[model samples]
Target chain A: MSNTQGNLNTTAEVGIVEDGGSFPPFDSTTYPSQLLWLVLSFGVFYWVMSKVVLPRIGGILEDRRDRIAGDMAEASRLKQETDEAIASYESALAEARKKATTMAHDARSKVKAETESARAAAEEQLAAKLSESEQSISKITAESLSHVGEIAAETTGELVKALIGGRAPAKAEVAKAVDAALK
Target chain B: MAGNSGNAIDPIHQFHISKIFPVEIGGVDFSFTNASLFMVVTVAVATLFLVLSTNRRGLVPSRAQLMAEMSYEFVAATLRGSAGNDGMRFFPLVFSLFMFVFVANMLGMFPYFFTVTSQIIVTFALAILVIGTVTIYGFFKHGAGFLKLFVPSGVPAGVIPLVSAIEVISFLSRPVSLSVRLFANMLAGHITLKVFAGFVVMLTGFGAVGVASAVLPLILTVAITALEFLVAFLQAYVFTVLTCMYLADALHPSH
Candidate 1:
């Protein structure tokens, strides 16, 4: 604690130069030797930073950009494929729909035509049958009248001849009676 | 102190740091010193450390590999915390500065070695380098609009000039503050340690009571030494963190 003379002298020696040297304000005069070296150091540091270190960082960033771009492109490509597939499916569906509708329409029209023609043919057959029935009825009526007429004529002729024979037994009455019977 | 008296205390100083070539434009006294040598040494050491740490190509992580990873993670964590993930880009500069300062500080603890960071010139150079880097990076990243750092956002237009002036003053003070912080901490701690050790030696030479009194300073000195060690690490951390913050500001000047 009381070793003042020695410690004080030693500590005092440190500032002796401080006061004598104007406290050295750290200007160019104080470090005149270091200027060139400082410039050189800075130059080297700047070069390395610009050339090696920064480039590596920039490269990493570029790689990330490339990766992102690639992924986006792949996604877009897949999306395009999906769109094309959907379009193809829709077109095929539309074509099938049109074909089915046409087929249905054609079938319906054919059925209608067939139905109309069949109805017309049936009407013609009915007309033919009606005409044939009318002809058969006429023939049957004609045959029945002729038979009645024949029977009446024969009975009348017979009655007349018997009267004439009974009444006048003459040769002239007998001859007329025989002629009537023969006619 | 007596063992190495015949040899000069510093050998690495022989390597030229900067040699002033004569310039007689306006009677300016320009000369170079050993400070440049240490700057070069710092760079070389930093380069060696980095290259060697990453030299071994092993996934299992050898000692150097582990050290390199730790160095990277240390700076990366600091940057991420201060400047968000954006700071990771500047990890090399921050990590190199931290290692350089840490190694320089530890080197001073060795006998007969110079403390580069203790010199105002060295610390100033480092601080100025950081400021210059951040300034350049900010402007480059944001172009001319980086001047917005001074005006900031959501400030009133009436006080724009005044606030901008103040902001400019503060911005200009960055290098001084950063350098002074490191220089003062190192200079003060070292001097205090030297002074206390002198007291211990001087008092121990006295009688029993003198020796007993030495214990107090000894304990205080030990505590201060431990604190000084923490400060050494802390100062380096603070410097790197501030550097990252400055870099972040430069990267996104609006922040």
Candidate 2:
């Protein structure tokens, strides 16, 4: 449609020459193309960014992520180890406490058992002493009684004999008296 | 063959870059020309786009803001996907470059518009700048350590020098290679379009039979024009991406 309008101007009539001059010299006849320069400049800058700057920045970011991940993992591992250590410590402490209480209970029971055995031994010693004292008392009492009997009998006989000498007729009376006393 | 139009100026002469500066210094020809003017215009337009897009302050961007956002996003995404998050920072440069070249290319599709990029000097200059920046950046960041980039880690020491020398040569050749790729593609596409267009005009200008024959050329022109549009955009995109890759090399100094 635009071509039908005959918009091909003076420049359009000219054809591209392969062997065109080395470069355009500054002149009205040969003007620089704005679009070309724009494209060229853009191309250059883009090339620099894509080629040089972008990759390094990427590397740095990648490095940062890696570092952060590594640090976090290390910290987590360390924390886990610490938690295990604490749990083990508490368990050990609880075990020790349990053992201590068991030991205390056993000691108290031993003390109570020793006290009961000591009390039984003391009771047996007391019973033996009481029996021996009773035996001695009985023996002493028997000896005293026998001595008194002997003394009394001898005195009576002597009296009787004196009375009989004074009077031969009294012999029957003395024998009767002895018999009554015996009865 | 349509009889030669006796008054027709040599069509090829139109492409000449007539000297504006009749002077030379140290064997270097520095001259202002149409190609230079277009370069200035491209830069000005690019700057204008950036300034206009960002000038207004808004929590929610308006149409212009959206346009600006999309442009940056498109370029940034492409760079990031190709390069990485690190490339995101270089969004402005890549985006601008793509826009400038793309706009220039589209503009040239217009009948009268000049294609400055069609010139080797313009393309070469741009390529040189990229290469130079990459080299400079590598040395600045890595110091002498940048040399190690060519030494591929894990390689045997016996072959180190040989490998490094090869790497250096290839690296040094980047600018020329880059310049030629863009220049060659643009030059070829434009020339083909022009020749086809010429055929359409000349053939149809003859009798009815000529016009019927001209239909084939016209159809071809239409197809070429559409294809050219794609080519224009593609070339720009390819050029920009390649530049980014080269810069990546410099930043990391990879062998």
Candidate 3:
């Protein structure tokens, strides 16, 4: 609406001249008319937006925001629970490992003690058997010494008989000699 | 009837207000003018656009619903950013202002369509509404303390009177500036476009050489058309931003 519309149009088929003068928008006469309609038009549009369209769109956005926030909160809670579960699981596994280690140590010690006691009992039985065998060997040797003295006295008596007629006196002396030899 | 080849090139002719029906009340001319027709048309089309687009209220949103949502968010964000969440109480008015002006400006770009916002009287009324609400609401909310808006902080006592006077003058001019900014932008862009189109029409009248030369204005007209579209959205944004700032000032009355 400039003031420079002086050269706009002087001839027209509609033959109207209201808009020909320096832009009719600047014309004070038309202000009331324009204002009346602008108010009516703006009022209706505002009513639609405030009372209808805006709220609808606003409601959808608000719903979407709330849903997303709820989902995120749930996800975080689940994650925290999962983390706790993992921690408890790990601790349980460590407890099992400690139990296994103590059980293995007890079993190893028990096996060693049993083997040591068995070995000690076997050694005591072997020592007693060895002493009995030594006693048998000494008894045989004493018996053989007594047998040698007796056999020598008999042989001396035989030799005296064959030598001449006085065998009885030689036998007594040979017996004494054989006995001393045995001693 | 006015679109005859002879008068088709008349740029100012499109702006004429013909009486579709004479409406006079008392001695005043309350006639329904051509401007009123387009104003009604603008509102109907904007309403239909929002209604049809958001009929479904789809969470996923159809194209029309998306557009409707965008328009809502555009003004919503502006209000929240400039005026804070409290300022959202005035969402209806600000959204109406932006959509009405934007649609009006866009409608005027078509042939034979009247640009409602091109009229200063119309834009001024809107500005007055905004500033008027701010003033009334500020006074009601803050009582006499709202007057402190004019007083600059950290000023010398001697210059306090002068600074406050200047501030008051600036505040008073708010409506004028607000209205004029939209009016001038729409008015100037339309005029430039008309001038270029008129050049094409005038040039083509001189035979082959004239028709060939008309291409220059044709190209410029096309270019300006693109620019005007951007201006349409920009002007509406600027208006809403200013309105939000004024409303914020009222709510808080902070300098």
For every prediction, compared with the true complex, DockQ reads 0.07, 0.06, 0.40
Model 3: which residue pairs collide?
A: none
TM-score of each: 0.54, 0.55, 0.82
* Superposed model 3: Cα runs more than 4 Å off: A1-15, A18-20, A84-109, A127-183, B1-6
Q: Once superposed on the true structure, which residue ranges of model 2 sit more than 4 Å away at CA?
A: A1-183, B1-14, B18-31, B82-91, B158-162
Residue lDDT tens for model 3, A1-183 = 222122223322333543345556777767777777778878888888889888878898898788889999999999999999999999999999999999999999999999999988998888888888888877888898778777878876666666765546565688998788767
Candidate that scores best on TM-score: 3
TM-score of 1: 0.54
- If ranked by TM-score, best first, what sequence of candidates would result? 3, 2, 1
lDDT string, candidate 1, A1-183, tens digits: 135323333332433334442333243454544555555654564455445543443444356568789999999999999999999999999999999999999999999999999999999999999989989989888998667545555555556657676543445554555557656
Query: Candidate 2 lDDT, tens digit per residue, A70-178?
Result: 9999999999999999999999999999999999999999999999899889988888888888888888888886665455555566665567665343445555565
Q: What is the TM-score of chain A alone in each candidate?
A: 0.59, 0.52, 0.58
For model 1, the superposed segments whose C-alpha errors exceed 4 Å read A1-30, A34-183, B1-50
Superior by DockQ: candidate 1 or candidate 3: 3
| DockQ, candidate 3, vs. native dimer | 0.40
